[model samples]
Target chain A: MDKESYIFNKFKNSLNGDDGAVVGKCVYSKDLFVEGVHFRREWMSLTQIATKSMLVNISDAIAMNAVPKYALLGVSLPKDISVGEIDELTNGFLKIAREYGVQIIGGDTISDEKIVISITIISKTKNPIYRKGASNGDLLAFTGNLGDVKKEFEILENGGKISNDSKFYIPNLKDKFFYKVAKFINAAMDISDGLSKDLSRLLKVNSLGFKPLLKLSKDELCSGEEYEILFAFKPKFKDKILKIACKTNTKITIFGQCVELDENTKFINKCKEHHF
Target chain B: MDKESYIFNKFKNSLNGDDGAVVGKCVYSKDLFVEGVHFRREWMSLTQIATKSMLVNISDAIAMNAVPKYALLGVSLPKDISVGEIDELTNGFLKIAREYGVQIIGGDTISDEKIVISITIISKTKNPIYRKGASNGDLLAFTGNLGDVKKEFEILENGGKISNDSKFYIPNLKDKFFYKVAKFINAAMDISDGLSKDLSRLLKVNSLGFKPLLKLSKDELCSGEEYEILFAFKPKFKDKILKIACKTNTKITIFGQCVELDENTKFINKCKEHHF
Candidate 1:
């Protein structure tokens, strides 16, 4: 197992393996975006960095069909950070919070050698969708294009610049489509850690596997940081989902269907792990 | 102003300066404990590090008169971290959660060069006490002894050893006393950044100053990471607070009273700032 999975499995019994933990009507989720580890300072501006940090966290709440209500940010900044940089970082967070109608509650700030941010998003969901609800014969689909993020990531790593509109800079979360189709979907999650890896998790929770309907390359299958919605539903709801997708202006890709687990249940992830 | 305060001041209109943010009946708080910034690995075990991180976050909730119900931990581990060390780290978090009847909901973990933890505690409060309610002539008091944590911190900095039971290792939180006296106290906070610095915040919010009733040295006044309760209450409830303190087996020292601000409203914080 990967180190992140190993560490997460240790607390499996005490915590849920869903996109976010549900307590009553509240869904709590946290994500960390650290300097050097998650992104290079040269690759993106502080506003882009901070904006992605909040968006990725908000994506978790949206995946759970929750409306993010508030956010608490934990930022570890560098010692020589300037006032302009601080303004940019705070403005980045404020802009996203305003767009999502999320209250910037409270958090802690400390000094470190790099800029590290850990954000907690508290969302509300009257009808929450967990990752464990997929069943046999359920149609599985993902939103938007995938392989593009991996291409962007490689370009940035090689001293090449990508467009400001790259998903690496700002993830296009499918909150509107997800919320409208939440009641129709059985299981769902945001594809932050690529399709294969994240889909493996969705399958594992239901003790099921997938039968791919469309052929996808390793580049597409293992593209991480694509904040697209991966979801499953009864095959009968496919038409309804497609209708909502058009209404919400979302591009839905019907990639696979849930099936009984096989001997090859393990999904190979060739993408470089972002954490370690 | 310090960089931390300056950054926070920019968001003053949006976020609360309270120990935790109150959203309806829920209180949310986040705190970061980074390696080198918060402690050296040589000075603390992984268990001690994890334990202290959890306790400090809990202090925020308790200071707001809230009971922590769920915690989301964001841990950044070194690349060479071992399986055994992961167990020790998780065990530390589990132990505290069990003690407080808190659920370890969900969190994100990543790889870095050193251990960095940012924890978000979601607490519940029927009636939360804020830092803006202190009135003129209200008495201010702190729990337990002060200055000991600073002495221990200096000892560790100089390669000197201290007892394991030092307050630096395990802060004796006044949750029991604070909860019982929640209705009586006008304002409250935990003194993580020294008595003088934290007291200045409480007074500033209430538009008040303080008159010291007892003599205190710079060491006692400027000791940081003490994690003791600093609170204000009306003089009429002094006896009641004392009675609750005795019943709860807490040490209460009434050392100051709130008064009108003077030219000396600017309190001197000679203690080294924890965050730049």
Candidate 2:
């Protein structure tokens, strides 16, 4: 047998130990955080860098609506970096892992010209909410509002201070209320790549789209990392979602609705123009 | 209360899906393959790149004694690359996933300066083999012979010609096994930066070291990319392990024992020391 086939066969057999306990099929995901490309070290702290690195997957796992269990991370850094720096990053990582109840079990470390972080998060759910599960009549909604991150980016880009102006960058306090809202979500993914791009991805995956009642500006369109979930659900749950959001003092927004497509198509903003 | 603690806790709880079922406690690992830095695009085919990238973790998972399950992969490529070339790498990754029963459920992609593939693999096992598990009294045994990969590197470094015409680099065959041997070991790891450097990591993690029963030379000490498992077990299992290797048709090398100390207690090789 070929190498891949041989490996999978062994992996399959290995799952069945002598005992009755059997591990389930895990839906796995991996991502990279590169210096300058994925993030800038100066803009964020070692703690923020580590948190964002971990959070990237936390957002992804939430997107799938699959309960995440573990994270394996690998990092390559320059020789000059002190062991103290690495320890700080690990503290950040372990803090995140312990919070999510996921363990930082194992990983690899090597030397390279730049800092590169690779994170793998594994989660399993009996009924994993996939991008394919969106229905034609589903209403599209977002857990939080946008424009703030765009505004924050603008402030930082054009000498605006985020911390000094609180109620601006992250406006709403969506704590426990937002968690409750997540349960009712049919399909969810963060608006990591502004509304225009991620909206395209979320729709393309489901093969559905809608006419946006509202159009976002260029800044809103390309805001790189919003880190808020955009979900699609039946319109009936709208009120319940709002009520839950209200309970936790978080904001909720209804961006648009999941509409029927004549052909096997992708979700686009132009509703009447649902051309395959 | 601290920043790291806050992010991890929220992220963790979100991953568990408090409303219902949860996936918990997983092992996820990631490695970055940089062209030229990590691998030369000119030297390796896309398929080999893909396979090697995946194999790095396969060996790692094997070292940890975990059944590899999921992968979070990121490929930052040059914009000039063709879709077909990208597909070749993707197919290579998918092929390995199918083979290892690893689910490439999700990850990220971007355009960058060079082709940077940061892969994170997730795995689980009730008993994870850790570098810290080995004790001073344990006998250090290794599966598969070293010096083979060093031979390949030597060939490349010296105009791709081996001094010994008898040397080889074929995928399979008893005389030259270049692939990894990661199975049934107490605590294991791949030899990426030669035995001298990599062994130091295993020894450091556990605050342990070993001595040599048989004498060795410089050739045997600093062997690189020997992607085999260096494990320590009770001497009583030595004969049984030899039989196991025979049954598996794998090679075994009793490189040395886990010693007490040396010039550097982290790792002590009775073999020749490389002094600049």
Candidate 3:
């Protein structure tokens, strides 16, 4: 048999309910993290590279209020990369997944022009929380501050100044804070395409328009990699949220709330006053 | 709500269940087809591109002995590629899915240097056939011939030599006879790497070696597009298989039966024999 055939056959034997078998519904989610678009390997350690690649989707699942369980990875490497480098990257990922109690189910390897890491995570929960269930009185809240990531992006892009505070703020403290806040929302989603674009999407899908109270600070507020999560809840669930937060020692921000359920989302932040 | 949130929220509302509405197992298989590595756009029509892309995966479910159900597609395209081109490409895939009674549930997209299509298929079946299931005394057989795809690949690779009847004849007949033949095999798999390589995968998985009576007259065959299936059967089901084939009007090739389990497989076809 060919080398490829040997690999596939090993994969085949790995299946079945024998020994270490774990099975669930057939799901697949892929994340292709390119060099310039996702991360720079220089600034981030291989551990961070593997963790960030996994966490983005974990955040997606968290926004859906689902428990992430399994992952499949596709790694495309340049011809010059070494086997040791590849193994280190995967080992880093393995360590993180084991930390989170998730399994590295399966993955693929291929040759590419750059390091394109395609990760697919399969998660489960009793009920998946979506962004469509917000009632008229729902309170729109965020897990952390929104605008700091754009500042980080600017710092990265310009190769300019990045405070230890700025670096520690987004990826370290802010990210940890949000993961805990994931399960507390009725309908939740992350602010990936900036608050403006993402909130617009939430409004469009829910078919509800809310006037956002955007009268806070404007700096680091416009747009950037705000991996922060924004979720909604009814006023009655506020106490439950508080209890969960208190137990976990996780901090959250209300940023804005569900002000109305009319047509077109009228949002407000430090940058713009509302009028729809 | 960004497009990501918008699309997901739509999906959630469409399928409402609290806590855990539905969560699927991530695919057991994931593969990539790249430009210059797999197929070129210059040769295949839009329909063929779509059909072939999805068809490459149809038997993967069969490879796992699972019922092929849903597909998640990841497509990366150049900036010059029109939206119309993408729509045409997707429509071709949707057409193929419909043919297989499958659906394209969900997937993501991004930009890339060359066209790269990565697919993950979710198959549903109670008792998924596995390559490791073939025991000693199991009769090894294939649903179709081996040499046709090799012939076709040669013709296509050599600048589409229309004058070469030798290269094209087998593939043309194969195109007509392939799918119907696919319905008859047990533990069937598509002949991707070639019978020699693929059979090696099968034997190793089953922990049994077999005689490869490959009556193939060609040497040095390497084509990534061969979708023919190979399978194993029990002696008790022999009459049932013949009856089914007779009724369905499909040919079943009894290549070589499994004699005793061995690490190395022996080849015997047309009174000639060899071992590796």
**Leading candidate by TM-score:** 1
Where is model 1 chain A poorest over a 10-residue stretch in terms of lDDT? A265-274
DockQ scores for all the models shown?
0.76, 0.24, 0.10
Residue A256 in model 1: lDDT: 89
Model 1 C-alpha lDDT per residue in residues A1-276, reported as the tens digit of each score:
588888788777535788899989999999999898889999999999989999999999999999999888889998899989999999999999999998887888888899999999999999999998999999989998888999999999899999998889999999989999998999999998899888988988888977889998888788998999899999998899999999999999998888888876444456665557
Residue B19 in candidate 1 has what lDDT? 91
Residue A273 of model 2: what lDDT? 16
Residue lDDT tens for model 3, A189-245: 666556665565565557666755555455434564465666788877788776776
lDDT of 1 by residue, B84-172 (tens): 99989999999888988888878988988999999999899998988888988999999999999999999999999989878999888
lDDT of 2 by residue, B86-195 (tens): 66777788878888788764456666677778776666666555565667766776666667766676666666653332222222222112122223345566555567
Which run of 10 residues does model 3 chain A get worst, by summed lDDT?
A13-22
Candidate 3 lDDT tens digits, B1-276 = 122122122223211111011223222555665665566766565556656667666656555445556665656666466645666776777777777776665555566566667666666654444455576777776554456655565667787743332322212123233333334344555566666566666766566768645444443223334455567877777777767667766576767666576445553222211110
Candidate that would win on DockQ: 1
**Local error of candidate 1 at residue B69 (angstroms):** 1.0
Give candidate 2 misplaced runs (Cα > 4 Å).
A1-27, A66-69, A82-102, A123-127, A154-175, A209-222, A263-276, B1-27, B98-101, B124-127, B132-137, B158-185, B200-209, B258-276
Using lDDT as the measure, which candidate wins?
A: 1
Prediction RMSDs, each to the true structure = 1.6, 8.4, 11.2
